[model samples]
Target: MKTEDLITRLAAEAPATAPISGGRVVMAGLLAGLPALALLLGLLGVRPDFMAAMAVPVTTLKMVLPAAIALLAGGAALRLMRPEGRVGLAGPALAGLALVALALVVWRLVALSAPQIPVALMGRTAPQCLFLLLGLATGPFLAVFWGLRAGASTRPALTGGLAGLAAGGAAATLYALHCPEDDPLFFVFWYGGAILLSGLAGMVAGARGLRW
Candidate 1:
């Protein structure tokens, strides 16, 4: 057959929609394992003292992990879901801005105050304000992944959100285990904060990235 005819035949045979595979399972497993790993790390005494004046850098590193994980996983998942689609850079950028704005609005509306900024933030000794800022900065990259996952699947937004929540929660739980600060306030503020921020970021990304 001629090359053009062969190409046309191949195109005709391809399914209009890609086959559903085990992508969700992989996402679920990653979501579930993060917390478990953190617990394991904690048991192994991998605590970093963020309270120490000189430990600022170390604490910052710890704070950035969740965002980094989200970005990495989300990016990979997006590519897998739609190999032909381009990355949703704009989605993440918008989501990141929205995340920060929403956080500030909540802070202002509630007039909430922390007991001690560091202890209340991540339960570690690092500067809570600085860590939160860093988390906000990393929101866009992670949001891209969330957006991709939501867009790729036929699943509902709620389902996608739950998956994202699971991923974020699991990661936060693990981070808490390794952290020496056992304050509920810290988890509520920092860990919980991370999940909520990431979720919103995901929503924005999904809305943009999941276009046909």
Candidate 2:
């Protein structure tokens, strides 16, 4: 074939955009895995009583690290996944979902009715508020990253929800490993709270990021 014709054929077959880079996939996996790894490290050779009390805070910090990772990873995912442009309605829709999810988490927390209300609200210490704020900051970005991946795969809601559930479950499992308290109250209050927050953030991201 003539050179001109060969060039035309190649152009016609070229993808409209590049595929997700390998580095991004690796980064995402690492970010998602770090918390679990931290939990394992915390558990090794640790006493149960000390582990139980410290586990809550440690797990909370573990969760926070992933959110930071997600923020960077999500931005990269968004850039790669939507080379064409951002799907409309993703930002506003996600914001709305976030509002609803936050409300639900708050309601669940309130129902726990700890003997000392502030302690429950604030977790074991006042510093928990700072951790929660960190979650809030990075959670949305993580959601957006996962949401983009879901959108690329054409299963936005399902992917987003799964991401949320995974995050929740991971945190819960870590807490469970360390927690001495086996009562339903512990799960309902502490474990449940983490899951709910993560899930809500995931839903918001899915709602927003999935839009085309």
Candidate 3:
């Protein structure tokens, strides 16, 4: 067979529908996890005083920080889905946001007396926060990863890590409504730890599965 004819035949055989965009894939992933996250929230029950707590800047900041991270990281993940896409400002933006969080944590730490430091850091729900944040993020991560599988990503680990961090951050934001731990020290360390853990898992998975 002539090479031109063979190429034409293969092109004709391609699927008629256009593949979904990375933004759509990320949105779909969020939708996919909504029901599960809702169920988890229902089971845990939102803290009765969430509204009041939200009115407090310090307490509400816990939610805002994670939501911001999710937004930025999710955008970065989509950008990386394209072979030609560069991370651009996403890396430095993420770093600056993280630094802001750490600075808040440090400020909170200093505000506490020496004896109160340990209790504030540990919080009553430290372990539960970690487990629930990771668990809630699982479905989103899997959905995002599955959706991105067909993309010609040149930076798989970064793509997957951002997706994972996005998933974890979103879940953590929702989880905050249910979580009683409002201290910057506690959530910054434990909640941030959970998000990073998700990013690590995605990095490993991307290394194995996202390679073309």
Candidate 3 C-alpha lDDT tens digits along 1-212:
99999999999998887865976787788888898778877798889998998999888878998898898998888877889878789889999989998898889877999999999999898888898889889999999999888787899988888888999889889899799988899999988999999999988888888889
**Worst lDDT window (10 residues) for model 1?**
132-141
Best-first order by TM-score: 3, 2, 1
How high is the CA lDDT of each candidate model? 0.47, 0.47, 0.88
Estimated TM-score for each candidate: 0.42, 0.43, 0.92
Best by lDDT: 3
Q: Which residue pairs of candidate 2 clash?
A: 90-208
Indicate the TM-score of model 2.
0.43
- Tens-place lDDT digits, model 1, residues 84-122: 444346346535634653564465335536545443544
Q: What are the RMSDs of all candidates, in order?
A: 11.3, 10.3, 1.9
lDDT of 1 at 42: 52
lDDT of 1: 0.47
* Per-residue lDDT of 58 in model 1: 33
In model 2, the worst 10-residue window by lDDT is 125-134
Model 2 Cα lDDT, one tens digit per residue, 140-188 = 3363455356336354554454355445544444334344443333334
